[model samples]
Target chain A: MIPALGLIVGIALGIFLDPSVPVWLQPYLPIAVIAALDAVFGGIRAVLDGIFNDKVFVISFLSNVVVAALIVFLGDQLGVGSQLSTGVVVVLGIRIFSNVASIRRHLFHA
Target chain B: MSSTTPPPPPTDPTRQESGWSRLLEAAKPRANRKTAVATALALALGFAVATQVQATGKQGLESLRTTDLVRILDDQTSRNERLDLETRRLQATRDELVNGSSKDEAAVKAATERLNQLRILAGTVKATGPGITMTITGQPGQVTYPTLLDLVQELRDAGAEAIQIGTARVVAQSYIAEHDGALYVDNTKLTLPYTIKAVGDGDTLQAAMNFPGGIVETIRQQGAEATVTKAPSVLVDALQQPPTDRYARPVPSASPSAP
Candidate 1:
């Protein structure tokens, strides 16, 4: 509940402030978003399983975003940025799908 | 009464908790500080995501070099200025056409006058009016191409609207060149005693030629006889072939006033 409220406030602040992002970070934003989504879904799954840990959830979210961005950065240095980005997205996407499936089962039992 | 229960399984009191159960215990939310930290992190992540999405929605402008972005801005500004000027010109033309009958009549009159002026400059029609005539009788070598050219220049400077030398109409693109001890005006040969008729103010045309140290004095100095006459009506009956421009055709305007 707190995280959800935080997210809402953060989005409002972003809209009202309208701060511009730096150019160098442009390539990493999409990857980081995907990774954050994966972490959020995982956190929801943990909550359904009665094992939700705030520290673990936040750490996982930060690490996921950072690691994803780092992989893309390394790939860019190696001239394979797009390929590495696709690989990271595929892995994180699979995890998000599984977590969402579990959440759905917990909520709807279908 | 009864048989004794089966022997109880032996228990080890010193056995430690398994790693899996310990990990599950740690994964559970515990303190207020941990929850606060998580919320703060989530807020920051959300803000970053929202801002980045908004920035990306600008069609990837952030990826372009600063110089390239500035060049695109400058190009758009210049193009906008040119389009604005074109729009103003077209709007003025539209207003002139749409205002009222009196304005329309004035516009038509102005257009007709302009057309007549252009026709005169093109020399496609014969011109007759009050002006001056100059007749030059000289030795074959006395009145060269340069002398005739100078006379034409002087008449033009004195506001002679239309001019004819011998049998050739002096339009904007007329050329006079000397060849084989004679002169050719627009490729037509001229005989001696050339007669030049010009349509303008007769007094001004006469004075322009008779000005001290002007064409007349210059011609007399060269042993030629020059006579200037202010006639009530001078006729230039020569016609010019309509010029054919291979390029530079007019573009039709987009406004409704276009004809």
Candidate 2:
């Protein structure tokens, strides 16, 4: 979970400071890689003891990218790109909170 | 229990043969280790390839970021351009009002009255064509600059090719606005009941004046009287010399040039 969180945060920081980087890959890559790493490091712990559900990881990965892109495209069509970006940030903020909560629960064994 | 049941033959020859085979095969466990090592190498290679793909993916992300930045900049630039145009227009208007005549209050009132009396004299219906008349009325409260600009914008939008407020014709650089609680139309104080005249399509022009939620309605709501009429022709002289500051040079009189 710590490594997964780190990957996501790293990617986010990189994209924000250098906007030329493609944001579309942001949601899936970090989470997928982290989850894979977790599976390697802690084996059965992921299935029986880790805080994250594999399904949630996959769903968030799919939804975040698609929803964010769709919203930006829609905003462009409506002539309100800035407004759409603000919305994306809000959604991502919520996702970050949930992810942190999961991490905390897993690490604390709660 | 096995001793009692094992009398059931050798359970085929396999059990006896496997015991002999295992004793013979103990030295060849090296092959099994080699296979295990090969599998580990394959897994390691797969992991390396996955990491390489992630690096390529990061490059793609960088490209998208640049694109968003350009788009953001372009949007801001367009907004800036629009504001700049509006600022220049307002500046020109301010210059016209500051440098133009200040006696517009009396002239516009007189013109309004003249128009009203003329309307009464000419009756509601007349064969008007080329000439135009404008009416200005303000609310009891202080006149605002936005209101003044609104009137001017409406007139321009209405397609009035030629327009005059008080004694000054509307020009490319002219502006209308309010300052110090007074309404100003082109550098001149314009009290209530201002009259403006223009030359162009009378009916189309009149329709333009009373456009939805326009100055005409605003004026009427404020209890200010306004009227527009097209005349056969109304002649107007060129604008008077604009007022100048003490800092500027005095104008020479219209006289014959010295040889």
Candidate 3:
């Protein structure tokens, strides 16, 4: 419950800070940085359950970095990079939401 | 050959949850999936409420000047800033459309017809295969109207068949004005270091302005502003107008004279 609540609260605050800020600055927000902290929490959960995989963690990290940079670059070229950066954050947002949802389900499953 | 999937990882407490169970026991009613989902949803709802409340509150406090109402005042000011930016962008688009479209179709058609007659009068539809260049610079402080007008007149007297100021075409009838301290050429705001180009005879145009107290001399006295030069290949485009209706009749004249 705490993790899920944290994820939602963080995203809400992120959106509220500059709901209309040029999309480019979206991924750079402290909120997104904090949201990425979820994978750490997930790693913790996995280690506790003896199911940690270094490969999965590494791949996820690499993909996030690549996608974020690519969005910014493409946006800069097309004159919509700021908006596209916001889109990259949205992708991160979905991941955070789903991870929280799954953790919730895992914890509460009778 | 059929391939068998690898078995799921072992859930041995010895390797995994050594201290997690103790932590879980200390924190009773640790949220299950459903409870966690509910909590997340609640948090989302709370944030939405707070955001809306702040927005409406800011709008309400715009007229108030209470010393303690700093937050309210700042929000209102930022909102206004965003609105002003949007207005400027829209205004630019509107000007682009207006300047692009046909202004006086009938007059343009008449002008074109008159040009054809003049071509017959001059015995040729073409002006010349060579021209001169007129480099117009702003005054030391800023580029203003009188200077711009003088430059335009000089180009005209120099027998310039084509003239372009900055990026805008110098049509037969174009209006240039300054609004809110920004200089606009043909209703389009120009950036600094304005350049005006003219296509005409180099020698004839040069000789025409060779007299003392000419445009170049006047501009030079004004300090670091406006220059005119001759070019080998100055291309002037004959401006075209949108087609007018062929069978349209003129409006009946209102006879206001003493009858």
Distance from true location, Cα of A105 in model 1, Å: 0.5
Query: Alpha-carbon interface RMSD of model 3?
Result: 12.5
- Model 1 ranges off by over 4 Å: B1-31, B64-231, B234-259
Candidate number with the higher TM-score (1 or 3): 1
Report the lDDT tens digits of candidate 2 across residue range A1-110: 33333344544544444333235544334333333333222221222222223344333434444555566666656766556666666655554554444334434535
Task: Give lDDT tens digits, candidate 3, residues B6-90.
Answer: 2145456453324445335423446565345434534543453444344435444332223326657688899999999999999
Q: TM-scores for all candidates?
A: 0.44, 0.29, 0.30
Cα lDDT of all candidates, in order?
A: 0.81, 0.51, 0.54
Model 2 chain B is weakest, by summed lDDT over 10 consecutive residues, at B1-10
Interface RMSD of 2: 18.0
Model 1 CAPRI rating: incorrect
Q: What residue pairs are clashing in model 1?
A: none
Q: Residue B239 of candidate 1: its Cα lDDT?
A: 83
Error of 1 at A37 (Å): 1.5
DockQ of 1: 0.18
Per-residue lDDT over B163-241 for candidate 2, one digit per residue giving the tens place of the 0 to 100 score: 6666555556577766777766667776665667766667767777777777677767666766777676754433534
lDDT of 2 at B69: 67
